[model samples]
Structure formats: structure tokens, C-alpha cells
Target: MPSTLHETLIEMFRERPALAAEVLTGPFGVSVPTFDQALASSSDLSAVMSTEYRADAVITFLSQGEPVHAVIVEVQLGPIEKKRRSWPAYVANLHSRLGCPVQLLIVCPGASIARQCAEPIVVSEPGLSLTALVLGPDAVPVVTDSVTARRNPELTILSALAHARTKRHRAPVLEAFLAGLDIFDQEHAELYADVVLAALPKAARAHLEVLMTTTPHRYQSDFARRYFAQGEARGEARAVLAVLEARGIDISEEARERIADCADIDQLDVWIRRAATVTKADELFA
Candidate 1:
């Protein structure tokens, strides 16, 4: 549904406006806070610093109380527009409107382009870094919070990307990938399960027939995929505990039992927290 990169980025940002700041300052690279403290901003989202209207969907980021400008983001979905005419004015007006220094970022779906300096220094001023984002199937979707990928449309996007990576073939069509995964072969089965997990809507997958046929073998296969790949199985109990332990969580036998029985992911998350820290050797879980 989100055909263009600009549309996709904008939609994702709106899903987590706070992420705009995180992505801006992250490895996507402009200068950003770590993913852990991604949304702990100092700026008042309700505050309107400058009325310098220049373009549509070109957004800016401001640190909460910090004077330094956080970031400048432009969602370019299509060919350059006449709005390029007003970019200089937009930059200058933004500086005068907001006290923080601004950095320029051009976020595109497929490719990015940047200009070192703006000719109308009065408007754009100086020291604007141009950058781009070309997110494609081969690209891994930025992962920060679980919900970032857990949500619906985004879940679909992540599944597409992961499947694209595993299959030596060209990026598979979304529907085609689903059909391929429906077969449930042995070798690629675990990998396909990841795609299914990634593809399942936060609301839940309605078409889980191939995945949820529930025969002894199919159930075992599904359970194996969840347990091994996600460290949710008997084979993974200790390992899952280690990851949770890093965050100071501890696991118990009862917790392990609870997780093993949980086919629903939401419930599994609860047990994952408990076992995350209580286990010993990574190899045991490994």
C-alpha cells in the first residue's frame, strides 16, 4: 500500500513521531541520541517556534532544552518539486524561528542526494549537511523497540525485507513470499517462520492455515521454529534467559513452562522477561 519511499517514511514516522528524532541522530547518521534514549527529547512537541512554511512533509527535529538544532528531515517521495524554489527561505526562516542550530537531511525511499552548501546563505545559512536514506528489500528495517516492528504494516515491511535476504532469488513479491512460506519445507522452514512472524499483523494472522495446520508435525515444526529461532524452545530456555538477564530480569522453572505453552506472542513476551536473566551458559541455550 505504501508504494513510495516518502510515503512509507512519513507513515512510519507518524506511527512513532518520536522515532524521527531517533533516526535522525542514529547510525542513519546525522548526529542523534542512542537508540536506547531515542525519544527522551527536551523539546516541547506542542511548541511552534517558526511559522516559516516552505514545503509539505519536510519535518524538523528539536532537542528538548538543548540550543543546538536536532535535525532537518525532508521526505522526498517523487521527483523534485517547485518547492525547491523555497528551500533557501525555509532554512533561514527556521533558524530565526527556532533558536537551535539545524542540520539538513534528505530522506528518500530509494536513493538520497545532498548539497554541501546552499547558494542563498541568507535563507539556508551555513553548515547544513545533506544526507539520504534508500530503504529497499535488501535493507534491514531499522529496529529499536519491539513495537517498532511488531506493529502491523511495519511487520509486513520487515517480513518482506527478511525474506528478500534469505532467498537467493530476487526480492520476492509480498504475496509470492507468503505462498512460498506456506509450503513449510524443512531447510528453509525456520527462516520462513521468521518471515511469518515478521509478516503477522500485530492484530494476528488470519491466514495461518499452512502455519497453523496443527497436525502433530506442523505443530512441532511451528513450535520448533518459535523455540529455536526465537530462543523460546527447550533448546533456547537458557539463552532466552541470558538476553533478559542483561536487563536485570530473572527466570524460573515455572516461567519456562509458561513460555513453552504460550502460542500467542504477547503472552510469550511475559515469560521472555522472566527467563532473560536467570540462565547460566550461553552455550546451553545456544
Candidate 2:
């Protein structure tokens, strides 16, 4: 099954086909010709009598109704030999159908996977090779400034996904991301929040939860409601456990399990108060 992160990344490109062009020219410094419009082209590159070969997305840049360039956008989370093999075919078919030069853009969140995808693929034709333009964590710029993030919200989302692991960049990156969320509708904002939250490290995610509570204006979508609830439950659970440990109470395996498994705020509140003074860890439940 395709992960939500993978689907969200693809949907971003599909929503704004020009984003592919922006990435190609922005980070990779590829010279893409000026186009009047960018359209989502057919990702189906299968020929007659051939097995189905679908790509993540195909974007065609048009100038005066003529196809000038096409881009094959593939979101790769991990190294897959099969995908590497089929990439050449995707480029070849798109070029043949559109009668324009085609470039393969591989989006990888991990640097290791990006390096793997960046390797050249050799074809049967002598001296013929296809080198994919890879957008990895290194290529993705950390948009920490709220002004820049608001101006280019799409890129901010990409930055969050790519640089979520970086501690120094986490605060500003998350701030910009949450600020940009207002540009999207309720549905998209929820999905974007889910993707950003899931991509961040544990510490970064906890920090974002803090921001959500302190600055509720930044997160006014329905997603915020659900995320805040889950975060509160987790925080309460941790507090209960912390108090038990601090009080020198010996917690049994079952007692610890009960605390960890709890999601109710009211129940967790009771347990937290009990943990501070209870003689036995198991007494919290009583």
C-alpha cells in the first residue's frame, strides 16, 4: 500500500504542475524554457501489447499549445531496483508521445536513497545512459522565514518533509509550515499537517505540539483538533509515568502497560495526581 506521505507528495505536484518546473529550475538549476502553462500529462506510458507502466506523475510544459518539455516525477522513499529499471522506459515513452525532450525527476526524502536514484541507468544502446535529477534532503532548502514560506507554501511543505530531522531547523521550519497552512483549504490543510507531523522526529513533533497549544491561531483547521487531542493524551501518559518514577514507586509491567495504553484525558489526569502520592504504582488505578 502506498503510504500517506507518498500520496501527499504526489498530490502536491498534481495540484500544481508548475511545482515540478520550480523544483527543476530552483534547486537543480536546470534551464527549463518559459511555458505559457503546465498541465498534468498522462502518466500511463504503456505501449500496445506491453504491460502497464504507470509513473507517479507526468507534467508537460506547453508554449502556445505546443509541448516544449515534459517531466516525469517519481517519489521514491526507498531504493527499488525495479523502479530504477522502468525509469528509462518512462522517459522514452513520454518523449516519444509528446515529441519533446523529457527529464526524470526523482524525489527522495532520504539522502541515501537519493544517492542511489542519482546513479545513471545504462540502456542497450551503446553509450546511452539516463541520469535522474534527484531532489533529496540536501537539495531541499530549509525555508525558515515565514515570509518566504507564505510566498512559496509548496516548497515549505517539501522542506518540512526533507529537513524534519534537523534540530536547528525544526522550529522555524514548523512555524513557516503552519503559517502556510492557511493558504490551503480545510481538506488539504489537514492532509498537509498530517504529512508534516508524521515526517518530523519525536522531539520536533513534541515541539510542534507545544506550538499548537501556545499559538492556536496558527493551527485552526480540523486536523489541529485531532492532533491536539492525541498529543495531550500522550503528554498526560508521559507525565503519569514520570511522576511514578520520580516518587520511587516500583511500577509493575501491567501497571505501566495500563498507563501507556490510556488515551482518555480525564482518566490520565486522575492517574497523574495519584502517581505523585500513591504508595504503590498499581494504586493509581484504584
Candidate-wise lDDT, in order: 0.42, 0.86
Count of backbone clashes, every candidate in sequence: 12, 0
Worst 10 residues of 2 by lDDT: 215-224
Off by over 4 Å in 1: 1-8, 33-53, 58-68, 81-83, 112-286
Give, for candidate 1, the lowest lDDT window spanning 10 residues. Answer: 38-47
Which candidate tops TM-score? 2
Q: Report how far residue 86 has shifted in candidate 2, in Å.
A: 0.1
Query: How well does candidate 2 match the true structure, expressed as C-alpha RMSD?
Result: 7.9
TM-score of every model versus the real structure: 0.37, 0.76
Tell me the tens digit of each residue's lDDT in model 2 across 65-167: 9999999999999657999889998988888898999999998898899999988998867899999999889999888877887788899888887776788
Estimate the Cα RMSD of every predicted model relative to the unseen true structure: 15.7, 7.9
Runs of candidate 2 with Cα error greater than 4 angstroms are 216-286
